[model samples]
Target: MARWSNWSGRQRSKPVAVQFVRSESDAAAIVRTANSAGRTVRVAGAGHSHSPLVVTDGVIIDTSGLAGVISTDAQQRRAWMWAGTRIHALGRALHDAGLGLVNQGDIDRQAIGGAIATGTHGTGASLRNLSAAVVGARIVLASGDVIECDRNRYPELLEVARLNLGSIGIVTRLQLELRDAYRLREQAWQAAFEDIAPQLESLARATRHFEFFWYPQTDMAHAKAIDETNAEPVYPLAAEGERCAYSYEVLPNDRPHLHTEMEYSVPAAHGLSCLDAIRTLIRRDFPDVRWPVEYRTLAADDVWLSTAYQRDTVTISVHQDIAEDETPYFRACEEIFLNYDGRPHWGKVNYLERETLAKIHPRWQDWWQARERIDPRGTFLNDYLRRIRPR
Candidate 1:
């Protein structure tokens, strides 16, 4: 058996077989073969997701072989790329074509398909998650059928494919709506948590991108703000640390350290109170929790499975060092988030089951219906999907 593990080394699996596919046809063939053998099939991208979305005992389709830019339309500001293209590579490719992703998360190591599938996002009150920018995609179904979907084509299916949790089908290629290449100005500073907590709402409304990392054990918080600017790039002194660069270059940060993370989205109105409660709990009980808790805001989207579905959200992410036991901490935080009507990030760690998830997401059943239409046999369903999305 071939062993596989996630980026954070929290989830591991030993697949019966791992096949590296180079094209859509290759992926289709693998799916057909697996179906014929009565075995399940799952596709693995960069394996950045903390959840066991890709863990499988059957055949594993590795998509890295089907990578790179396929086509670009300058007039329409759209680009087509293979699903396996990494976010960083996509950024550079689009930049060369005078285009850029509308928004991106801090970590750029995830494959484009995986990122969109999991509803990955960045910090921006006005900007939507990466899934919203997906205008079209080519998905290979369980029976080896290739379906092309977009707004003009299978509009309904396009919605399902946008934020698919690998339960619908394997996305072979994607066509994304891009923005004209732009520059951004970023400023970062450290401040006390109490001082910034009260002003977070106004700051989020005013800035294009505003997020912060608050240390649970201390009163310190690292705040960052970014905004689109027409000014030329500048190099500032150490004291006046401001960076001006291309949108992609300035958005992603280098994360050399690894940790297990759990993130949930709450109603924008109750976000601050939730954060305050979490801070109080951590300080009073889990004194050993030292990792910073990240906070960011996101605009709502129509994607069915999106955490910010149909409502603006404030996302809170709690992390623990790789060496620490995250069970107690994550469970406690989950309880707090659930009190505020939180929706967990699909790709991150969480203990929510189907019954609970259905209660929180208004379109949960709708998403499952779409999943059944494309993958009736559940060929794409792995153990993780089966546990959370039972038949």
Candidate 2:
């Protein structure tokens, strides 16, 4: 047996065997063998997810061997990439092809498939989550069969595959709808929490990307805005206050600190109130919570399991240093979020179960039906998946 842990070191697993797969056939064979023996299988990517989504005692298929860009089509603005490609690597490859990812989160260490699988996203009023950019995918099923799905082929399956929780199958390749390479000008500064609270909506709509980090116990928040520009790239270390750089350079930052995070998305209408409530709770009840609270927004998408599904959303993320116990703080925040009818980010920490999730996601039943059709034996399910999305 081999031990595995996520990037945050919060979730761990011991699998009977760890197999590094380089192709679709390898993944399919592992799944088929595991299924035949009545055992479950889990695919481990970069392990960036804080959730126990990858924890399994069966066979573990490590997808790192499948990394890299497979092909690109400039005419259609599409790029086919192996599932294990890291977001940072994908960005560089796309830049070389005169294209770039439509959007990406601040941390670029996540594997491409894992990022989209959990509905990972960046902030912008008009921008959707990364899963929304997935136009096609090739999933290897437990029966040793590979299925290629897209809007034009197996469209219903494509919808489910877009943001699958890795329940349907092992996604070997993804065809992302890309955009022409672009440059962005970013401005970062500090602002009083009260001063920025009321203007969140306007700021989100006006900027290409807008996000903020509120330092607990302080009245100030670090706000950042990134907008497209035609100007020359500005040195990232320039002290002129504003920096203009390629999309990839400006979008991601060096996250030297390690922490565990819990994020939830509430309807756009309840965003402000929820944020205010969280701020008050932290200031009054959990003064010891030192990690910053992150705030961002996302446009609605049709992906059934997406946090922003069918409704524009405001995302709030609470983080705690890896050395501290996050349970109490996260539990309190989860209560406030649930009051606002928030949906938890799949990859992040959450306490929701199937009944609660079913209430928030209208398409929950439909998504389960699709999963049943694709993975009848539940070969991809782990304890975490079974709890949140019971069959």
Residue pairs with colliding backbones in model 2 are: none
- Model 2 lDDT per residue over 213-296, tens place: 999878798999999999998774453237688888778877768899999999988988998999999988999988899999
Model 2 vs. true fold: TM = 0.97
Question: lDDT by residue for model 1 over 272-342, one digit each (tens)?
Answer: 99999899889988988889999999999998889999999999999988888999999999999999999
The C-alpha local distance difference test score for the whole of candidate 2 amounts to 0.89
lDDT of each: 0.89, 0.89
Scored against the true structure, residue 375 in model 1 reaches a CA lDDT of: 87
